[model samples]
Target: MIDLLKEKQAVLDVQPAQSGASFAPVLPVDIEARAVSKRFGDTPIFSDVSFRLARGEATALVGANGTGKSTLLRCLMGLIPTSGGSVHLLGQQANTATGRELRNMRAQVGLVSQKHNLVPRLSVLSNVVHGLLGRRPGMRHWSQALAPQSSRDAAMQALERVGLADFANRRADRLSGGQSQRVAIARAIVSAPKVLFADEPCASLDPSAGEDVMELFFQLVRDEAVTVVFTSHNIEHALKYGDRVLGLAQGRIQLDATAASLSAAELRGLYD
Candidate 1:
């Protein structure tokens, strides 16, 4: 059963599940920020920031507070417009795409933030089902009670991936900090998104809980072969979980290096 699930998951991740299995090819460059820049009024947030994320790549965005890491992330996701340059996602010009086109592109993307953002009154299963809203809308997705069987099953599979299947029926408010974060991760991956964007995802947890959640989160990301772009205040996480590190400082990309080639000390220097 485990092997079967693994095989099925690879298909959801757009990879070939097994020998001779049909596959969908993701573009070589999943995300590209071409000299993008942002500003709020006269205050510049970031300028000339650019990077490309390949399919299934994991990159970490690291920086000191107020360097606009979050702003840059939002721009990359097309949640906000860049002041200059452009962002391309999944073969479309994200910033220039039509409304429907942008929505369609975003349907294949997922997000996880520091806050769990779960509906406290709802069951964990229902919260996970909500991740499908970008693709599956209307009252049917409002709760597990109204959700179709297929939706429920997908939500459960996502819960299982985060090791929270047993808590599917529990209320979202009844979970521990670590458990809530797990549910958040399950929600993000429920749609088998081509790319996952996480902004300080562990920022709200204590050290011990944060460490545990980050481990589980990255492990699941690897198992599903998902591309990821996450911002981290923790240098250890930046080096440990990412294939490449994109550092922000002085209103620009101060450092862009392979994580394998970057020492912790060198990355820490960017924070100074």
Candidate 2:
């Protein structure tokens, strides 16, 4: 299955740039979650979970299943209301932001989930171009396309970064799982978002593919200065790729440390 995806990806036209580019934030973010908590009726997910992601840093959220990792991501994105405390993104309160405020805030962050979330019938290029939806809301349809040439050019360039530019004309559903994930990464980064949130980005991939995807993510972080926050179940990958790892258990952060400083015993204790 992986080999087939790689073959289908061969058709993509990746347009490498003359020189790599960097994304410097106009105002750097000190993302902080202060005493945040969440609950579903009688079930509590977290209590007083606090942490911060300094600008230009990559943080890995690691935990066993059903530990509220996804819920925390949604909370950071303001998709759901928090039961207590607050989430600050780029210094803006996430939970209380209004519709327009939320939209503006969301424009600064890009999300890539385990699911590609692409329209199956849409062309790969079209799906990538949809990354501009937050920027060009007026051009909602393929027929009514109004994105500037620069935006399209950027999207194509992003595809190239992920090595999938040639698949631009193919339907999204035709690509393999790995290829689709690559496309999703391109879409997330094309917008030059200040923060990139990836939820279990390599969850469905085999070991090799998972490493490749994680390497690509780190490359983006180093090359583009895009702050990344991702959830991962793999402890080795977290230690290898993450500058810092936050281990979550029972809705709260159990261990937060630099990868080099984290020991196997400490990591094992996080799950206990």
Candidate 3:
């Protein structure tokens, strides 16, 4: 029965960039959560959530609003402490890493939040150049005027990939919402980090612009083999863009399966 469904749906996006490559098993679990939990004071946001992903894979996180999707992402990134259990990132323990070790671990990953997170006064190029802060970590790369020519070049190359190089010198405040999101994506990919996390990156844009951004995003990251984990409310997107689908509902992972192994109807059921 599962084989018949798989043949009927024609799943998309597992190994999207390299269509010829087989959907191999996820081994080595570069990112993992073991019985993780989160709370705000006495209010438990979630409990006992756990999953794992391999390098170069893409997973889509979906759940009803207030299910703690964003909070869970932060925990995995080591931005906040988990209430209980453990998270492993790049073979390093997330909760116990020292200050320097924590910084080093974060440097290997990228994040594109729902908000653009760009400095309004800075130029578009400068915002993208900030992606290198994880690697550069100094006053030198703070702005285009102070950054070395090499950094500027790398920033420009990233903008070019997103087709935004011409706007490199424009003030970030002047761009439209869609354009701002594109710059955000450029910033996320500029470092070519091993992992990328996006929290509803296109939620603010119109449908057309959002579609374009998602396409451009997948194209760039998959080409670089950057492992991706993004949260989205769109069910079709979960089915279409992720190698795996993880559904969070009632404060736990209610569904865990490959995109190809699941159908849109199955995902929608998780919402209620």
Pick the TM-score winner: 3
lDDT of each: 0.89, 0.81, 0.88
Report the C-alpha lDDT of model 3 over 1-272, residue by residue, as the tens digit: 33333343354324356466677554667799999999999999999988888988899999889999999999989999999999999999897787999999999999987799999999999999999999889998899889999999999999999999999999999999889999999998888789899999889889998999899899988898888899999888888899998888888877777898777877777775
Give per-model CA RMSD. 9.9, 11.9, 5.5
Instruction: Give a tens-digit lDDT track for model 2, residues 1-272.
Output: 22332343343324355555875455465578889999999999988988888888888898878989999989988889999999999778999998888888898889999888988897888888888777666664241145577777888899999999899888999999889999998888887898888999999888888889889878986797778888988888788878888878866776666777665555666565
Q: Please tell me which predicted candidate would have the highest lDDT against the true structure.
A: 1
Candidate 1 Cα outliers beyond 4 Å, as residue runs:
1-27
For model 3, state the Cα shift of residue 130 in Å: 0.9
Clashes of 3: 0
Question: Judged by lDDT relative to the true structure, which candidate is superior, 2 or 3?
Answer: 3
Please count the clashing residue pairs in each candidate, in the order shown: 0, 6, 0
Q: Residues 75-167, candidate 1, lDDT per residue (tens digit)?
A: 888898889999998888888887889889999999999999999999999999999988987899999999999999999999998889999
The deviation in Å at residue 140 for candidate 2 is 4.4
Best-to-worst TM-score order: 3, 1, 2
Q: Candidate 2 regions off by >4 Å?
A: 1-28, 140-146
Error of 3 at 103 (Å): 0.6
